[model samples]
Target: MVRNTLQMIAAGCGVLFVAGGAIASPAEVTVANAERRLEAGADISMTRWHVDAELILVLEKEASRKVTAYLQSRGRLRVVDVSVSINMDDRVILADFGPGFLPGPDEAEVFLHELAVTLRHYAEQAGLPIVGVDFRYQGKPLKSYYPAELAVPPRARIDARNQTALVSASHGLVRVHPALNWDYQRPDAFGFREDMITPPYGDALQRLLEERSGSGVNRARNRSQDPHPESNRPWDYMSSRYHLKTLLPDRTDIWNSLPNDTDADREVKEDIRARPLYANHLGVGTMISLHTNGHELGAIRGVEVYYHGDKPDDRPLAESVLCGMRELIRAQPGYENFPARQDASPGGHGENRIGTMPSVLVEIAYHSNAEDSVALQDPVFREASMKGVEKGVRLFREGKTCEPFVLQQIPDISLAAGTSQEITLPFAGHPQFPVTMEFTTANCSSPGACRPSKTTFDDPNTPITVLMRCRGSLTGDARWSVVLRDVDGVATAPVEFQHTCSKPGGSPAA
Candidate 1:
């Protein structure tokens, strides 16, 4: 049987009181809230309220008690604190449980399933139409549960006729994230995984992948390299027996018409055709395509921004992107050979020719070059390239360019009380270029919560480590912000760290 008595501590406005009484049944609690909403002509199916952290804690405590009661009726099990977050806009209930809340993985699955059902039942009884329940264990996402009725419909059944109806929307730029090769069946293309290319660069342009099709197509089969081994040689196999197969596809030679005979070429052509129609519908003024260059000779390196010769307007945007890339390439330690160039050819590739808006194809770097390939794999290098592209796009849009060297790193720090820890901050600009960064703490529970070894980063690639020492009495969380600046005190974007100091001899809060 469920417990009847309950104790609620009420503390607010400098007053504290303990109220002991019989707990109201779930049905009674539900009816009260429902009736109140109905009397006010409010939607009884949804509840929206702004709650502070203290109020959330109270709700969590109440939820834990009811959940524990329900579980205990079936079997004896220990219950711990539960964290709850309600998103009224999304109609989601996110619950996180304390560590070791479940006996094992198997039991965790079963317990969570039951917990979701129980919570949904109580929420429905309380007249709240929660669309889903997302549960986490020890701060890691565990599982998400949603009613069958709330599930999204599958895309396969949707009719294709209506897809192009919304293509006429206007946009400032229709960007395309391109793949390296057209061989969708194989992963060996140097240009494969170019889809991952969007974030770092798109973030720079102040645009998003959703704004345009980077590859100009959705299907993996549309943008591939020639299966003919000679046309699409792997970087590692370029100097080996792979050379015996055939000669590479020759689109660079001015005399040859751009190849569009292969199945892959036809597929790409059709895909490219659709982009212009979509761009016109959307009223986008310009287009940008992203790609990585490749050559049989690894000696060739650097970036090339290609624009359709017929489209004079594309020159300025291409030049801006090239200038940004030049700065980024020069900043890299051993990448001084990566010069930035612009190609404005009349008979450019199909991608450059198809867009109604002014368009440019940016070859970030040659993947065949060993050094370039290594840089391509580095997250910091990728971020720099993206930032450069972003600066160029900004210059084109606003008639001004602000290229600020960025310092990017993880934003959270945690240490045990009376202990010290060091954090390394990574920068995404020139390593040798001196940058001054100032770190300051805020919302510290006690004095002397954190200390910085140095306030400036003068060396390139040398990570700055901050020594954070927590007082023995310090607990809970604090924060620190680092501002990157030039020697003249010009500040760029500021990165922050969430400082967490654990209670003495206790684990820190998640």
Candidate 2:
């Protein structure tokens, strides 16, 4: 049974008083100067900006209540996807006790109440609203959310269309206006076991395996080198979480064009919206990337909100995450040893554009640190990690700006013609910060679908011209244009070149 009694989660303005009303049509709530609202005000501002990417925070936990607590705090929550990795060697010998290590009903309620209060505070400061809250703990997908009831048609299958159910007894049967069009109703949980690893992408991905195996990222990878499964890769060593083969198909599969012919970052930002973000009545959204950094590029400990040095959408999110990570990390009993920086400054001295999305790669502390190594072993760290994550999401919805991605150099310009000029532009700082430049032009006649049939940019910055030997009668003022773009972002700039076409040198076809 769920508890209905309300408790004070914060002092005065920060208290967690229940907005006593029907949650069935809960409206976006804020606490800066307004009272809690439960009205179903149409959130017209809610729109799909970028593809939703999972804010994965990895840790080993056995129903860590604290970890879950950090998640519930975010007031603008919808679907929470919580996953727990347990110590394989653990001898708990108490499987029958169920989620004993988890927070009890009272603790869960209070924890969630506190999370909501804290998140609302950040959202108010960031000038954004909150919505849904979801929990995907221990690999099992649980939620304190309902789908957009009005959006889903009655009698329509939930798998093919939108179908939502309320979590709270008071909400009754109502569907949510899913920020992204995703089916809340899934297939029966038969093969869904927590311990087993499922295919990253679904069958659609598995079918294309033979073809994707030939991609550059794979062909270029040294076959002999493989990181140990039991061990983590070095900070400098970026094991692609989106490497075509390994990433789960789910929303990421179609969103990012995984194992397919498209830019990886572009694929992530534009395609993967089904990945859960802020979920509550307000329908706020967020994106986060989790990876460990090494080599002490800067201060080693605490999670950081990493934004694209070239973009602005991720700046506010990054700042919020950095602040939350440092505070939460320093406060955790296990990780209290590491120094905390509340200012939460970002250190993305690496690339120009970070994959066309408002995202942050939280460096969850240094694996090299002896003290962090011990902290990492504790489940509380994951709790800290989740809190930092919640903060980042809240900040993004509030529209806070951290820093814009600086316009640096896109090196080794390799251009192609047909439909668009495909130039492989590599950034100045790190090789990992690679991007492609594609622009379309009337450079080719009798067009069906002309693209950079081929691209060559090993040095990256070296400007090279493309020659297309097409024998055809070319008659007209043939104009050519080059549009530089971020596949992952809508922000782009192009350069146009107008020239006369010639049919195999028929007086330059002038």
lDDT digits (tens) for residues 1-510 of candidate 2: 001111111111211222233221112222322311212233223311110111011111212333443445533223333342211122001111123223321123324322322322332222122331223334332221222311211211112111111000000001122332222111212222111111111111122222221111111011223542322332112222222123344634322422443322322222222222111111222224443333221223444344543344446656666655554455445454454332333222211122322445455554445555455445566555555444344434444432222223333221222122333332221111123444466564435423443333344356434543322443334344443322112112444444334444244332
* Number of the top lDDT candidate: 1
Q: Model 1, range 288-324, lDDT digits (tens) per residue?
A: 6665655443555666676654455566767777766
lDDT of each: 0.47, 0.30
Worst 10 residues of 1 by lDDT: 165-174
Q: After superposition, how far is residue 495 of candidate 1 from its true place, in Å?
A: 28
Tell me the spans in candidate 1 whose CA falls farther than 4 Å from its real position: 1-264, 332-338, 342-347, 401-510
lDDT of 1 at 490: 34
Q: What is the TM-score (0 to 1) of candidate 2? A: 0.26
At residue 442, what lDDT does model 1 achieve?
55
TM-score of each: 0.34, 0.26
Residue-level lDDT for 459 in candidate 2: 41
